[model samples]
Target chain A: MKSKCSRENKRKLENKLFKASSLTLTLISFFTVIMIFTILLVQSKPLIMKKPLSEFLTVEWAPHLGKYGLATFMASTLFTTAIAMAISIPPCILTAIYLAEFSTPKVKEYAKSMIDLLAGIPSVVYGLWGVIFIVPIVRDRVAPPISEALGFIPVFSAQNNSGYSVIASGMVLAIMVTPIIVSVSYEVITYVPFEYREASLALGSTKWEAVKKVVLREAAPGIAAAVVLGFCRAFGETMAVLMVAGCVAKTPTSIFDPCYPLTALIANNYGEMLSIPEWVAALSVAGLILMLIVLVFNVVARIVVIRTAGE
Target chain B: MDKRKIEEKIFKYLMISSTAAIIGTLALIIGSVIVKGAAEVSVNTFINDDVALFPGEEHGILHAIIGSLYLAINSTVISFLISFPVAIYSVEYMKKKSLSPALTISIETLMGVPSIVFGMFGLFVFVLVLTRGFTLLAGTLTLALLELPLMERGIEEVVRMVPVSLKEASYALGATTFETIKNIVLKQALPGIVTVSLISFGRGIGEAAPVMLTAGFNPFPPASLLEPAASLPLAVYTYLSAPGQQGKAYASAFTLTIIVLIISLISRYVSKRFTRYVSR
Candidate 1:
């Protein structure tokens, strides 16, 4: 009895140790987000001290003249991502509807993997492809035609004939975010109970009608979450966008204008401008802004997804 | 009714064509890589590390390939250590807690943090004080952090798949939670855990932004963890910028693509096999 009790005690002690270690590790992982925010805040303190936060949000961005306005980069990031989202969302949803409703099981399986393969391709390769393929196509084929036809519209005018432009970055980002949005929307559509579709079909609606009315309606929240996730993805994408975004520090007035994004700004200059203290702080501030926006979108999306799954 | 029928038919075709368009885009990207990169690939491309300076000269990405593998393996190992434990803690200890949702939200948020921000983190934290500069160690740490949320979420998902009944049976047989977790949960989730590790490893290898910031680019191979290193993605970026070196860039991108493809394919195959075994 004594030996057995001691053995039980040993096991208990070991279990306690295991639990403690795992809990410590979990806390460490949890603290990482906090740590990242804190570090960025600390690093940006110098810039925040030199100038008010409002100063950085203005339009001018000549850092050599002590001007560090980030409005141009911010505007470029938003416009590029907006263009990407606008272009990608419709086709992505339609593709998801196809995968979820139209395809045979075997075909769905193959298509699913194909989409997965597309997602698995690295951003840098996408960047390379954008440079080699998409850039020229945009410069020569797409932009000139549109610019000539709609030169009256300020947003359609071609400011430069350079291959590197906002539209090029937007197109690359659209391609990059397609797999993500499609896959997530596909899963969400599939999760809409089949009985709901059956009920809709029983009312004499066609398959497309059932999907458009019942399935998509049921999955709207989850689909919204997926779009938000895709937005986060395209917004924070650095290298691919950097490669095609022209890296110019000017506010773009047209889709064919070369524009710089926040990610590109930080990436293109972080290495070379490390010796300048204020510039480093400005870069840190850039990262902080990126983190905040991504975090908000991510959290909102997660909550929506969790709520939808619960339902 | 006739108009509605016509509309349905049109929409069906639209959906089909849209999907086909997506597939065509994928095909175009992959086809371009293969066509442009295939002719440049040679034995020397994987064996030699020198860059060709003059016309008709040959060079290989031997160093960049090795450096990428080195960083990827080390980062995956580091992330696995933290992620696996946290995954267990989340599923085993925190699942019933009210704070579970918060933890899940945190992890998901972390997942969405940009890879470039991670690079910035590495640059500021590890490069400034820990390693004193851009080193393989700093890059590894950055990549590890970048991958941790993904790995933990993946492992947690698989752990949640372990049937409650089996765990209850273990407990009825007088097993402690730890014993049940070790002998049953881990056993059941091992394949999935391995799959997640491979996926995250593949992802780590492909990320260039974070690694570019943390791991200073070296033309030659790294001699130690403390020194700067080259990576396949960086190689693609650098070689693409050099005049007359587009072929090498394509080759490097092709090689990186192949590595990512192989890893994900293996994981998929293994997971499918594991599921089949479980069904049997």
Candidate 2:
């Protein structure tokens, strides 16, 4: 009877221990989020307090001149991400459609695995590929032809033919994000009910018409979520963009001109900034902005996902 | 009828071509990396530590390879320990009440935060404030944070996949809840947990930005967790950008790619095998 009582006490103790440990682990996420905000705010306080916020809104980013305006970097980030989104969305949607509605099981399996592998490739590898292959291709083959034909346009009027421009980085970003967009959209599209397709077909619509008119409409919100996720991914990408985007800290006048996005700016300059007065603080504020932007994107994406998944 | 037929045909062709384009791009990226890197791969590249300093001299990334393994293994182990418990708590202990949706949202948000931002956070908090300098421990902790969401979500899915009947059977035999979870639930989820850890390992190894900030650049292998270390991705980044070191960069990238690819392939294989087991 005494041994049985001891065993019961031991079991109870183990249960309490496991529960306490698990609860502590679960709270770590909360702790991390709080810690990140605190650290960023603390580090950025120096710059935020001394510099008028208006100074940061200017177009130039010459740190040596005490001008830390983020206009150029913001424009560069938006421009490159816009180009990437424009180029990647159509192909990604089509691929998702093919995977969800059309491909044979064997073909889908192989294609899906390939896409996963593509997604798994490290960003540095992508950057290296951009340096070696994409940059040269853009410089030698794509840019010259475009410049010759459309030189009248301000965006194509650059005399220099260096491939490291906003467009090349955008293209690399497109390649980097295509798999993500395709996979997420594919999941959303596949979740769509088969009965919707059947009803459309039964009502005399073709498979293409059903997919276009009914299925696509139903899955539009989830697809939008996927695009937003892709945008977030492209916006924060550093290494590949830094390698191919020419790292110029100016507002790009043309697609052919070099540019610097917020991420590339931070990655390329953070090391040297530590020694410069107020530079580290300025960089921390930029990091804070980037984090907030990504946070908003993620929150919106989550809401859309939950609503869609709940349905 | 003819218009509809043409529209269908056009759409089909577009989808086929787009799918083909995706595959083509993947093939092109991997193929080019292999072809360019093959020339630079040599026995010396694996053994020489001064590869990054010399433009054309015989050198290798031995230090970087070891450092990467050390970082990846340490971070994965730490992340697993933290994430596993959280997964079990949220999935099993909560018992259908489900942890607050807010917690899930926050975890997802953290996952979406830019890695560069994480690097900055690590730089400010760990590197500067806590450690007072770049160190391997700072990088490892930052990486553990990065892997937390991925590992937690993965283990949650795995635990949820554990059939309820097994737990019920254990309880019906007079097992306590903790006893049932420790034996029946975890035992069934072991393969999936392993798969999740390996996937996180791959992610931790491939990450460069966070490591670059928290772990200062050092060509030599680290002697302790407090010392600075060179990671494969950081090495690749440095070498690739350095003038005249392009060969060494390609070689390092090739090595990194092979390691990442192997981890991914193994994880996929394990998941596939376990999925079969579960279905059976």
Interface RMSD of each candidate, angstroms, one decimal: 1.0, 1.1
Residue B153 Cα positional deviation in candidate 2, in Å, after optimal superposition: 0.8
Name the best candidate (by lDDT). Answer: 1
Model 2 DockQ class: medium
Provide DockQ values for all models, in the order shown.
0.78, 0.76
**TM-score of the second chain in each model?**
0.94, 0.94
Candidate 1 lDDT by residue in tens digits, A19-74: 88999999988889999999999998888998989998999877667778889999
Compose the digit string of candidate 2's lDDT tens values, residues A1-311: 99999999999899889988888888887567767877888888888899898877788777777778898898999999999999999999999999999999999999999999898888988988998898898889888888889989989866666889989999999999998899989988988898999999999998999999999999999999999999999998888888899988878978888889999889988789988758887788788888889789978987896787678
Looking at model 1, the pairs that clash are: none
